[model samples]
Target chain A: MRLDLFAMALAVGLATWAFRYGPTRLNLSNMAPDSLLNRFLNATGPAAIATLFVASVLPYLEQAGGHEIPLALGTLAVLGGFAWRRSVVIATLCGAVVFGLASALV
Target chain B: MSAPADAPVTATPQPMGFRDGLTAALPIIVGYFPIAFSFGVSATRAGLTGGEAVMLSVVIYAGAAQFLALALVTSGAPLLVSAVTLIAMNLRHLLYGPALLRRAGKEASTRQAWAWAFGLTDEVFGAALGALARGKRFSEPMMFGLGLGAYAAWVSGTAVGALAGGGALAAYPALDAGLGFMLPALFLALLLSVLSRVQIPTIAVAAVATIAGTVWIDGTAGILCGMVAGALTGVLRRPHAS
Candidate 1:
């Protein structure tokens, strides 16, 4: 293993380690409902998660690759499966099947 | 909190432990396998050995960052560039902690809290939050068990992908190509699931902000911008709540 990779992981571990002191329901109880910090986190919370996932995957989308049709069809199948069933297993299986068939032909 | 009118006063139930966590983590384990497998395939394609690919999954455990690192390695970017970009990419995780801690319902001592933070990947955070919304009680043991199960799947999957890169799957071009879609599909699943539990307004705002950001900026920058826009909308929409 490269020293830098290990170091990077360790840094992430330590950075999150500091979050033990972050505000939680227990501490927030003492504050007002609309307290400045509390309000900020709440609003940021859902958005952070949504944007985070998008940002993480967008890079992969930008990578140079071909065969967009199969990828798209399979992805849509997965999303549609999820919307219908709300089950990861079913959606992934559906996507895999779509992806496999598309890949075979395309 | 008080019991309902018809309930008995003493209703202490079985405490959630490692076993419960293992069960809860099963879905995540199943979900992680294909992505980790893809990562393993990519890493080996980038000239990393099986051990190296598996090591990244074992130690780094950051999915996007590892993929980025493979890009860096393939392009021969400096090590510092890899490290800095990774830290920047994962910075959003800081937001997950406090929000998840609140949803998980109990405060931990510093030690247990740190362990929870260490295991707090995006999928795990989504699962933990979804579990809360579904009314499942949270416990430290359960959380750790969930993390461990997912961790094991990722590491082993990486190993399998890397070591088996030259095997039957690769021999079939279509099979190898199809597996590449695994991570994105998994992400889509998590996104849809999490959106289901969030308030409608928050979801709409987040969706709009993300779309605008993606069009206006690069991927990482767009994500940060979208998050800020979504947060601003959330704040404007609601004066209180987190």
Candidate 2:
């Protein structure tokens, strides 16, 4: 019940909510198909994913001294699993299994 | 992994309903539980009470930023400074809703956007885009279901982990490492699911920009750099119909 923690949570929560909530309220449905905005929006999905992918993976890679082989094989397993089954759950599970086994064995 | 310029939109997809969204959210729920658990452990270990740990998940709901907030607060940083820094780190989220709706096109309803948008976390946003790529029509109920499921898992996981205290997860070291890979694996799967040949250059640009930015400045800057770089690359290479 620290007042500072409460205030920080309230402020961060409100601001974060605003960030998540503000853009959806926009009426971007009427934009031209080839408009710059449309193009940017279309690309945002892949771009965002790629950005997150790199951001998420980098830390592990940076710290991957003893876990290098496991990490590499796990990544390949994820890719292969998705290619074979087209299921994110299956792919991620496969990756985790491979990573966990490899880590245990290595 | 296929090289088709676009994923085939097989038909007028049925608008996803609540059940469908919940089903789709299962993986995210799984992915979130361990991370949230880790966060709960970390928050408590850092001196916050179990209630406060759960409160952060319930309120802030930003995954990594909560960790950052813990460090800042525990280090006696000013409250406003900590809040501002966390918000700044998450500015990339501002693009998710608009970008999602744009891909949904004019046919999608936004009548409940104000309510559902609160659930639009990074994974939720990516999953929604993946649904669109699969030709599913957007429904507010589905978004609600998806967001709610993930949110519930996160909060519940945190509460359980907090109650269990810090040493709860330390016993399963290998499991802990594997769980750390879930978020990246999830994102990679989502990216590959919707990937197209036309977007390759944009992905490359984003990946390179993100790496460089991370190396030079910070992770947040890297994300922004990648997004802007990839978006511009996409616009530049997009074909004109007229």
Candidate 3:
């Protein structure tokens, strides 16, 4: 077990080092154009948002079943909290609380 | 050797230094610590030793897929199936690669690009992009510093949690179940922050489509279906000037 842990730790360090140094050795930055990179940059944010929506929200909605009440209530609480306080943490807490309470009550 | 001239600008100005990047990445590092701690706990519950759990995080470096693969493997799933599933789940990284390559390419060498690509995660990508959007050219060393900080937290967290035993994690049913919700909640929050009124309908439609598709397909495949749908929706929408 000790050997395995040591090996894993070594590998992690090596991987970090390689990732840190490898790009300097290869010089890829010059190969890609700034314009193309810009296009890619613009695309990534929406893509990431889409990916997150697909991966997380879609799954939650599916699990929520036919009754949209819990989801609706949760969304309202989250949005309302965010609107009132403009706080991500508060919005999340509101959603979680509403969801948990609705789950227990219903 | 110098900071890139054309890095994307952020709303708030950030100082271009290793110290600043470290400071910016601190929240994410702290956030990852406990989650990685849970992962370590879960890995040990599946009969892996501290070393094995740490190795999984180091090699895989993917959170959800790693946990899922570990669970599937310990549950007697065939090695091939587990391996394939893990690959499929992580295929999203392929998209992330090009995006990061473009942004970091200005200042980073080919070797550095490869390193950043390999080291990239949801948090790293978000933080780096957020930095870039602010017109900050993160020196390679700074990026490396941020990545390394998060990496250390993850591995150390796993090691510590594994050493602490899995029994305590199991005892807290709420925390255990809530673990699944954290990623989703974080993603939702991020999505909300990014979307404007114009994009809301597209997001809603894509999300609904994805939920509908998941009924027929299960597991990671459903996620792919939803992503495809969402991407299509995004493409169809008229481009907005940023």
Candidate 4:
């Protein structure tokens, strides 16, 4: 019964709903593909994902201490698995397995 | 399914209906379960109650943003800052509906847009776009079915995972550590799925900016800097040239 966490959830929910539902109402179907807004929106997905990926991995890299090899191999397994199967689930599972096995060996 | 030989011709294929949409959502449901479970595990690990974890899934429903929210909350970040950062991280969602509608073209009906649009997650958007590209007619019932299926899977998966409790994986030290890699791996996989020559620069710039910001300021500041810097670079780049 943490009121604060519930409150945060509701607030984040409302804002996310607005982002999801608002644009459909605006009817921006005619927006030029090259418009700044369009381009920014287009680029935002990859850029944000890239940002999150780096932000998440950096801390782990910083604290690798003795886990660097496992970490590196796990990342490579993810890349290799995705390149081969083109499935996020498979790739992530592969990476986790590599990470786990490497951790045991290391 | 192929059309009957005697079916009348039309510019668009017949609507696939709610059942088909649910069927189409099978892959998404499979994909979402593990991630949603991870989120639930992470949420409880971050000190949120099981109800709170499920509530976050039931409400916010954005996978990556939920992970980010958990991080921010655990760090004792200001509430407003957490909310704003989550919103910024999800801003790409604003483009999904318009992009889908534009692809669906003038004949598509958005009269029920307000209701169906609420389910336009990245994967949902990708699924819908893929459906349209396959020449299927758009229908609100189908969108409803797809969204409902994914939403149910997410919320239910979270509940189950939360019940597994925060330390459910603690006994498996390797697995627990590996779970930490899941988010980064997931994000990277997603980015690669949509990678393009045109997008390389934006990604590189964003990655560099995020690293710099993280080194000098903090993770949150780095995310903001990366997003703004990468987007601006994208705006400046010519469409045909990288």
Model 3 over residues A2-106: C-alpha lDDT tens digits? 553344334444443344344345444444333444334333344445554465555455564632565566667767766775444455555655655554455
DockQ of structure 1: 0.37
**Candidate 3, RMSD to the unseen true structure:** 8.0
What are the TM-scores, per candidate, against the unseen true structure? 0.69, 0.66, 0.59, 0.89
- In candidate 2, which residue pairs clash? none
Which candidate order results from sorting by lDDT in descending order?
4, 2, 1, 3
lDDT of each: 0.64, 0.79, 0.58, 0.82
Best by DockQ: 4
Q: lDDT tens digits, residues B19-46, model 3?
A: 7667767866767777677778777877
Cα DockQ of the candidate 3 complex: 0.16
Ranking by TM-score: 4, 1, 2, 3
Give the per-residue lDDT digits (tens) of candidate 1, residues B151-228: 888888888889777353766777676665555565455556545333446656766676676778644445556666
Give DockQ per model, in order: 0.37, 0.45, 0.16, 0.62
Best by TM-score: 4
For the record, the alpha-carbon RMSD of candidate 1 to the native fold, in angstroms, is: 6.0
* Residue-by-residue lDDT tens digits, candidate 1, A46-85: 5655555555456546767655677788879988898787
- Give the top-scoring candidate (lDDT): 4
